[model samples]
Target: MSLAARAVLVHRTTEYEELLARHGTHGQAAFFLAARGRSVEEVRERHERTSRALAEVTAAVPLKWRRAQVERADLDRFLFGPEDVVVVVGQDGLVANAAKYLTGQPVVGFDVDPGRNTGVLVRHRPADAHRLLPSVTGVRTAVDDLTMAEAVTDDGQRLLALNEVYVGAPGHQTARYTLQAPSGPAERQASSGVLVGTGTGATGWLRSLWHHHSSPLPLPAPTTPHLAWSVREAWPSPDSGTGHVAGLLAADETLRLVVESDRLVAFGDGMESDALELTWGQSVRVGVAEGALRLVG
Candidate 1:
């Protein structure tokens, strides 16, 4: 028998929820925020908005469809099926948080608090769910296939990120590795870390890095099947070279790195908890992921 379509609502825990968990009561949470010159009321209001939006989206799911909900914290443990339609109701980051776990699933993003969020990814609202759901599930709506970055370790571990991937030491210490660009001779280097990002990530950390240093390569457009990579704070020494610091990667190309340090980590979309660890001499390849984010309007 064919599997039934499922609507998976994904969201992150609001600040109000975290405050309550930390302080144990509304009054205590309020007091904690007050001491920091912030208002708990504002946090509570945002939480309520997200909660209401989630409820509306959940109710909008077709009666014949199966439904499931996964918080951002539990995404690593959640299982996403091929017949699932993901509905993300939160800020743009929440959408990125769920993207790595999905494989060509049609994603509907809702910006619950448009005034506060930039809403680049979560462009729709709760009320639009009623109209959008049918088109999405029917595969009749226009979907933007946003490019993503992928990192694969030699041992067969793989990670995908909608925004970008960071490969380096777990903490502040500098990471040592051999750098090899798509079309260049490999060179040994010691530096902070390496970052590889997709066009969907151009406006984020990649932009910040670009601002400090100029590059000949152009940043990819949101749906472009390309990647941009850079080495952060590459240290120059007689034993290390900085010639291969930054470059652009074509869809068919990849940037390679062989870890020279005791240990290194590869993480996507800023979720450090769900990361792949690499030891010395292990090689990692960063490139464009084959699957794109099927973002539904």
Candidate 2:
């Protein structure tokens, strides 16, 4: 940390103004990190607008735009200097990936969807980020609850999502896949597709299905524990058909379900995976990530 460095504000177009007004002050030099994916002109215009707005408040306050072509090292050099506090206001994906790379620093993410911002925020370290997430920033809405936003991946590595990760053919037709689990075995399902939901994913498509486990049951206190024994156990149905596990289904990284025999393919967070493939006799591991991203609620 350096005396020259103060707080950094990372935001999309909708959030640029208020964030500046909140953090930019007399002594603090506000550093701005721009979002990626927009055209160069658009980015420049936004940067100019943000800079101008900050100037109106205090001309001496240095509000500088991190150049659009800036790389990860550039983020390191410019954003996280001593005494610098980083404020992220856009997508979390970019934020998480960037947070994963950052060094010692204090960071506060302002927006709700940090996942989509990975294109810009992937340069920081995840452990360094803390959520100062707000429900409303001057009428710009943000999801304050973790459930409204996508689930955080275990190890804070990725987003938890199952409904959007279906496997099947293209066109107006629906895709299908076979479902299997270690304890439950296999079952052939027919519909738009099959979904594998984590506790975070329970509210969406998985909520509509009958067989999926919604969430882990809360345990009773140690002193209140009753003598419980199972006389007979009933389990879900078994099947021989094929289907795809929806939500963040990374092939090699998440799980590797057998798809070689059924022409199965995996899609993750609604995008096709080049890393994962279906194979025979391969046990597919799917569940919640190693941890959860806590919501303010």
Identify the leading candidate in terms of TM-score: 1
Q: What is the TM-score of each candidate against the true structure?
A: 0.97, 0.35
Cα lDDT of all candidates, in order?
A: 0.91, 0.34
lDDT of 2 by residue, 1-297 (tens): 325434455443434444456557412213334233334344345556545433332222234412122232244344454444445434443243234223434434433333443322223322323222222121343222221112222223233332223433332134333444433455444444333433333333444442243223321111121111010112223633433223333222333233324333433344343213443333333433332222221
What CA RMSD would you report for each candidate? 1.1, 14.2
Worst 10 residues of 1 by lDDT: 131-140
Least lDDT summed over 10 consecutive residues: which range in candidate 2? 225-234
Candidate 1 local distance difference test against the native: 0.91
Tell me the spans in candidate 2 whose CA falls farther than 4 Å from its real position. Answer: 1-88, 91-178, 182-185, 189-192, 205-257, 260-263, 271-275, 279-283, 294-297
Error of 2 at 188 (Å): 3.9
lDDT of 1 by residue, 1-297 (tens): 988899999988998999999999999999999999999999999999889999998898988899999999999999999999999999999999999999999999999998888888999989988888867867468889999999999989999999999999998479999998978799999888989999888999988887767886789998999999888989999999999888899999999999999999999999999999999999999999999999985
